[model samples]
Target chain A: MVKLKGAISGLGKMGLSHAAIVGAHPEVDIVSVCDTSTLVLDAFKRFTKVKTYTDYQKMIDNESLDFVVIATPTRIHYEMVRYALEKGIHTFCEKPFSLTIREGEDLVTLANQKKLVNQVGYHNHFIGTFRDLKRLLDTDVLGDLVHFTGEAYGPVVIKEKSGTWRSDPKEGGGCLFDYASHVINLIQEIIGRPTKANGSQLKRIYSKEVDDAVYSILTLESGLSGVLSVNWSDETYRKMSTSLTILGKKGKIICNASEMKIYLKEANSKENLGKGWTIKYITDFAIPVNFYLRGEEYSAQIANFVDCIIRKSQTEINSFKQALITDKVIELLIADSKN
Target chain B: MKMDKVLFGDNQFFAVNHLSDEKSREQAIRFKDDAAIIRVLDQAREIGISTFMCTTHDRIANVCDYVRANPEKYRGFKIYPCMPYAHKYANAVTDLGIIGTIKQYIPGNIFSTFTKGGVAFIRKDFIGFMELFIDAEMKMFKGINTPVIFIQNVLVDLILGLKMFDVFKEYDSYIRKKYNAEPGYITMNLPALLDSLNSIGIENPIICSSINKIGFRMSGGINIYEKYLTEKTFRPIALQVLAAGALRPKEAIEYIGKFPKIESVLFGASSKSHIQETKELIEQYL
Candidate 1:
C-alpha cells in the first residue's frame, strides 16, 4: 500500500481525532501539526509524536507532508484549502468548507483543476448505517421517495470562546453554515439537486450576530419534498446528532446517527444483515429491522477514502467541491431570516 | 341591475392573500376534480346542500356562468343573488342600467339635489342615512318575484358593535317592510343580533360567516353547535348550549352538514384541486 504523509491543522477536537488515527494508521503518517496556540501545539506534539508549529504557512513550507487536514474554522477554510491544493497537497476539511458560495466554488475549482484528493468531513455519509441505507435506496428498498426530513440541534458553546476561529463569519461560525451542511449533503445523497429552495433562520437568543436556529424546505427535481431544522444555542442540550427519515412509495428508513440506530420499514428481511429490531407488515407493524452504527461506519468511511486514494478511483468521497452545494443552502436561510 | 341569468365562481380566492405562483394554483386546483363550481354543487348534493347565495352582485355573472355551464350538476342548487345594497352597489345599480326606472319613482332630485344653502335642513333627513337611498332602490327590486338574500357584510357588525343599533334596526326594518317580505336572512356578523333575533324572536335566521367574514349570528350562537365549541369567545356559550340541549346532537350535525342558513357557502376557489378538497372536506368533516 502507498503510505500517505499527513499533517493536521488547528489541533482542536476534530484535528486531534484525525491526528490520533492518522498517526496510528498503517498507510498514514502524522508528520506535523499546525495551530496558533502554543499550548495546543505542545499537546498535539506529545500525543502524535510529530513536529508542531504556531504558523500554518511555516508548517506547509517546512514539513515533508503529502496532505493536510483543514480542521480550522469555516472562515479560514478557503485560504487553507487553497494553499494546500496549490502546493499539490491532498486535504480533508471539516464542514461547511467555506463561509460563502464563492469561496467554496473557488476552492472546488482549484482542487478539481489540480486533481487533488480532497474530502469533506460529512462523516454521516460515511457512517455504516447510512451507507446501508444508501444501499437499500439504490436497491429500491424504499421504492420512489415521497419525502425526507433531517433534524439536528444541540447546545452552542461560543465557538470563539472555545479558542477556535469558528466564531468568525469568515470561517463559518454560525449554525446555518456550520451544522446544516451535514443535513444538506445527506439530502443530496438521498435525493438529487433540488429544483426550488426556501429557508428561514432565527436570531441567537444568546449571541447577537449569528443565527442560532434555522429551518429549510426544498423541493427536488423529482417532486420529492424535504425539510431540515437546525439550531445551536441550546443550553438545554449538549452533543450533536442527526436523524434522517425518508418516506418512499414502498417503504421507509429512519436513521438516528447520534444514537447510531437505523430502522427500516421494508417488505421483506435480509438474513446476513443481522437480527433487526421488530418486523411486521405495513398495517400491522411499521418498522422491520434496526441496525446500530457499531463503530463500523467510521472505519468504513476511512477505508473508502484510503481505497479511493490508492486506486485513483472516481468516487463521491474526497470531493469537497460536490459537498459545497450545501453552503448555498446556508446563504438562502440568512437572506430570508425573519428574526 | 339587469343581470344575465347565469354566473361563474372563477375568481380564485386563495385561503391566504393571493395565488402567488403556479404551484399554489396547481395545488388549489388539485383539491378537486373538474372545477370548483361543479365540485361544490356535487358535494353539497351528496350531503343534501340546497341553496347557495353570493353576497355581492359582482359575483352574479360568474355564478350564472357556473350554473349555465353545468346545468345538470347544479340543478338542485338554488342560486340566491344577494346584494350588499347598504354599501357599495347602490351607485353601481345605475351604472349597470337597472336604476333608470327606479330613479324615476324616487327621482334624482332626492339623491343629487343637495343644496349648500339648505344643507342644515337635509342633515336631519339624509345626512347619516345614505343607506336609505339604497333601501328605496331595493324596494323596487322586490317586484322581481325571485328570492333576494341580502348580506349585511362585516362592516355592519362594527357599526352594531359600536352600539349604533339604530342603523341595524333601520336596515332590518327596511328589508322587511318595503320588500313586502322578510329577507330570507340578514347576513350581519354580530352575535348580539342573534340575541336581538332571540329577543324580538325574528324568524329570519342570521347566518354568520367565518370569524373574519364579518357577518353576524350571536358570538355564542355558533357555540350552540359542536364546531364552535373550541373557539375562545364561543366555547363557553357552546358549553351552555350543549347543557341547554337547544339542538339535539343529531340535529346539530345535520345543521352543520348543510350550508349556513343564507343559502350556500360562497368562497373563492382557484383550482380544481381546491374544489376536490372542498368536496372531500365537506363530505368528511361537514
Candidate 2:
C-alpha cells in the first residue's frame, strides 16, 4: 500500500501522541516533525529518523508532505492552519479551531475552496462508546432527543501555574476552551448544531487569564436543550473523566469512558439488546489499535483521516466547517461568563 | 438628572426572599396589598432614596398610579423598571395560555397588537415579538420618569446565552428612541453581559447585577467581577452586595464602596429603620 507522508507541528502531549500513532500506522509515514523547542525535536529525532525543524514554516517549505497535524496552543492555530492550507496540504488541527469566529470562518472557507481534507482533533468522536451512542441516535432508537448533559472533570490545572501557555488567555482559553470543547463537540455530534446557548465560565482556582470551570445550557436546532458542566480543577477524578447522558422521548443513553448504558421504554432496534436497559462495556466494542495512549481514539481518528485521503472520498472527519460551530458556541458561552 | 446613589429595590415588596421559605411566605402575605407596597416605597423615599429600581409586577402598576395621582408627594420620584417581571407572564401563561396571555398584558391598539403578533408569528420575527413584549412590560411605568430601564436577569442572561446580539441592539434603540431611557441589563453574570453589550457597540452601559464579597449568586465569581469593576468601563449598580444577608451591613457597604466604578448600590428594605440604616451605612462607607 502506498503510504501517505505527513508532518506534525507542536510536539506537546497531543503532538507526541499523534506522532506515535501515525508512525505506527502502516499506511502513513512521519515525514517531518516541527516544534520551537529543540529538546522536543531532538527527542522526536531519537524515536524516529524523520527530519525535524524548529520552524514550522521551514518544514512546510522543505518537505513535500501530504498533511500536517497541528496540536499547538489556541492562539497560534489560525496562523499555522492557514499556512498549511495555503500550501494545499490537508490539515488536522486540535480543538478550538481559532480564537475568534472570524478566523475560524475564514479557515473553513479557505479549506472548502481548496477542497482539502480538513479535520479537527475532537477524538472523543472516535471513541467506541460515543460512536455507539451516535449509531443509536442515528437509528432513532432513542426517538427525538429531548436533552443532553455532558460533564468533564479532571485535575489538569488545579493550582496557579506561571510557565505553561495553557494558563494564558491569549494562547489557551483555559478549561472552557480546552476541556469543554470536547463536551461541545460530542453534544453537537449527538444532537444537531445548537441554535442557542447560555452559560457561565468561572475562574475558581486559576489565574484571571483563563477560567477553571464552565457551566452552559445549550438549545440545539432540533429544540433539544442540554447542559454542559466542566471543571479541570477537580482533584477527585484520577484522570480526565468525561460522561454524557442523552435523554430522548423513548429512551436515554448514558455513556462514559468505561461503559455505555441504554435505557429504553420500548425496544426499537434490530440489535438483540433487551428492552428496559442494556449496558455495554468499552472492552466489548472498542477497536484495538497498533498504538494506544489515552484510548484507541487517537489511532482510530488518525486512521479515519488517512482512509479519507487515500480513498479520495469526502472526509467523515469533523471538518473545519463543523468545528467552527463549536467555536461559535464557545465564543457565546465565554461572552455569557463576563460580569 | 442623575439617578440616586442608593436605588431602593422592590424585591422585598415582591416577596423575593432568597434565604428562607418562611420569610418569603411571611413577606408575601404581609405585602399582599398595594397599600403595603406603597408604605415601603414611602419609607424608602423618606430615607432620601429617590430612585426605585423595581420589577414591573402587577402591583407596581398600582404604585405607578399612586405616584401619578399624588404628584406633590412623589415630586422627582423615578422608577427604573426591571422587566419583564417573569412571574407576571408566567402566571398569565398558566392561567390564559399563550395567545390569551398576550391579549391580557399587551397594552394599547389591540388591533395593531394582534396584527403584529400574527405577522411576527408567520414570519418568525422574534425581534418583533421581543419589542412588543418590551412595550407591554413598559406600559405599567408609563408617564413616570424612567431614565434607565433594565432587562431582568432571566431575559438578559437568556439573550446573552442565545447570542441574540440584534435583540439587544433593538432593545437599546427602542428604549432610547421610544422611551428616551438608557437600556440597562441585570444579569447573574455581569462581566459577560458587559462584554456582549460592548460587542454590540453599547459602551459604558448601566448594568445592575449581583456583586458581592463571598461570590453569593455572582455567576462568574467575585475575582473577575473585581477586575471588571476596577479596570473596565461601565456604570455598575451593585445588587446582592450583602450576599443574601451573608455579610454585616458595615462590611457589605464598605466592600462594595471600595470598588471605584460602582455608580449605585441597590438594596431592598421593607422597614423604615432598615432603609435609614442602609442609607447611613452608604453615607459612612461609600
Candidate 3:
C-alpha cells in the first residue's frame, strides 16, 4: 500500500504533537509544515527533513499534499478547512470544527461533495477505555441508558494569563469551547444528540472575555438526560481530568482516563463474571502504541483518518458531520447561558 | 409586608428536574399527590419560612387551592409568582392552537377580550399581548397575597435579547396597578437585566437570578455578579445558591450571606429534615 502525504498547519502544542505523530506513523509521510513564527519552525527543523512555510495558503498551493492537518486556532478553522476542502485535500481539523454552525455545516457539505476523508481532532473518542465502554454499550450490558453526567476539570487557566489566544472569546476561548467540547463530543457519541440544552458559563478566575467554567443540562431526544460540568480554573485537579457516569435501567458505567467500573444488577451475557460490579483500569484495556502525549488516543485518531483515506471510506468516529452536532450544541448552550 | 430572607422554592415539588431524569421521575411520582406538596410547604412554614417563590405551574394551582382553603394556617404565607410559566404556554399551544390559547387565557368581558385580542394582532401590540398573559397567570393567586410578581427569566431574557424595553415597562406597570404587587424580574444574566431595567427607569427593581459561589449559572461570571451585588441598587434575590448541588449547604448559604445586597436566598427541598437543615444553616451562616 502507498503512504498518504500530509502537512500540518499551526505549531502550537497540539500542532507540534500531531506533526510528531505524523512523522512517526509508517503509513504517512510529512511533506511540509506551516507556522508564522520562525522559532517554531526552527524547533522542527532538526527533527524532520521537510519544507516549511509561514503562510498556510502558500503551503497548500506549493505542496502536492494529499491531506492537511489543520491545528490552528478556532477562529481560523473555517477559512483553513474551506481552502483545504476546496482544493480537494482530505482534511483533519482540530476540535471545534468551526467557530460558527453555518461555517461548520458548509465545510461538512463541501467535504462530502468532494468525497474527501474528513475528521476532527476529538482524540478522546479513540481512547481505549472509551472505546471499550462504547463496545460495552453496544452489547447492551448496561441496559437502556437513562442519564449521563460528565465533569471535565483542570488547572489550565487559573490566573489571568495574557499572551495566549485561548483566553480570548473571539479566538474561541473558554472551557466550553476548549475543554467541554471534548465532553460534548464524547457524550453525543455515547448517548446521541440531545433534543434540548440549558446551560451556564462563567468566567470565574480567568479573563472577563471567556468562561473558565461551564455547566449544562441536556435532555436527549430519547428522553434521557445528561449533565456536563467543566471548570478549567479549578486548582483541585492536578491536570486535565474527565469523568463520565452513564446510568441505565439495569446498571451503570463510570469511566475516566484511568479506570472504568461497570455495575450490573443481573448479568445476562456469559462473559460476565457476576451480577454486582466489575472494575477495569487503563492498563487492562489500553493498547500499547509508539507515541504518547496524553495517551495512544492521539495516534489512534490520526491513524483512523489515514485508514479512511487509504480505504476511500468516510470516518466513523469524530467525522465533520458528527463534530458539527457538537458545534451546534455549544452554540445552543451559549445562547441558553446568556438567557 | 416584609418577606422572609430564606424563601422556599417550588421546583422540587413540581418535579422541575435539572440534573437527573431518574430523580425527576421519582419526584414526579412522589409529588403526584398535592397533599405531599402541602406537607412539604407545611414543614417549610414550621421551619419559619414565610414566603414561597414559585412558578405558576398547573400543579401550583392546587398548591394555591391548599393555601387558600386553610387561610387561618397560611395567614402570613406569601407567594412570589413567576409568570408566563413557559411550559404552560407550550402545553397550551400543543393542546390548543394560538387563537384558542388566547381565548382561554384572556380575562375580561368576551366582547372586550375579542376586541383587545384583534387589536393586538392587527397592530402587533406585543405589550398588550404580554399584559393579557400576565393577567392570565395571576388568576390562580387572586385571593392570596402575592407581594412580588416575577417575569420569568425565560420571557425576561427573551425580551432583553430582543430589546423590547416597552414590554418590561408594561409588565411593571400592570403588575403594580392590577395586583398592587411590586414587579420583580427573574433572569440568568442579572447584571445585563439590571442595566436593561435601569435604562427603562425601573429603579431598584426586584430581580431574581442565579447567584452561587461556583458561578454555576451566573452568565457574566462571579466577579461581575459580585460587583453588582455590592453596588447595584436593585433588590437581588439569590437563587440556585447551591449551584445545583455543587456547594454544600453551609458553603452555599455562607457564600450568599456574604453578598450584602442579596435580599433573599431561595432554595428547594423535598424532605422535612432537608428543609429544617437548610433553614437552620441559613440562620447560622447569615
Instruction: Output the lDDT of residue B284, model 1.
Output: 46
Per-candidate DockQ values are 0.00, 0.01, 0.01
B28-126: candidate 2 lDDT, tens digit per residue: 789889999998888788778899998888788999999999989999898999998875554333223344555666745343646655533523455
What does candidate 3's lDDT look like per residue over B4-87, in tens digits?
788899888765544333455588789879899888889889878999988888788988988888999998889989987765
Q: Clashes in model 3: which pairs?
A: none
Candidate 1 or 2, higher TM-score? 2
Cα TM-score per model: 0.48, 0.53, 0.54
> For residues A213-307, what per-residue lDDT tens digits would candidate 2 score against the true structure?
88878888878788889988775543567889988888888887657888989875587667898877564555555433345677778888887
lDDT of 3: 0.78
Put down candidate 1 lDDT per residue, A1-339, tens digits, no spaces: 557887888755456545544553457766788887564554344323568788888888898777788777677878888888889887778777777788888988888888877788777775545555666677776667888888776654433232224444554666666667777777777556654566554556444455566677877778888888877655333235566788877656676542223344543455223234432111111111111011224334555565566776545763776677667655655665643
- Against the hidden true structure, what lDDT does model 1 obtain? 0.51
Interface RMSD of each: 34.0, 24.3, 23.5
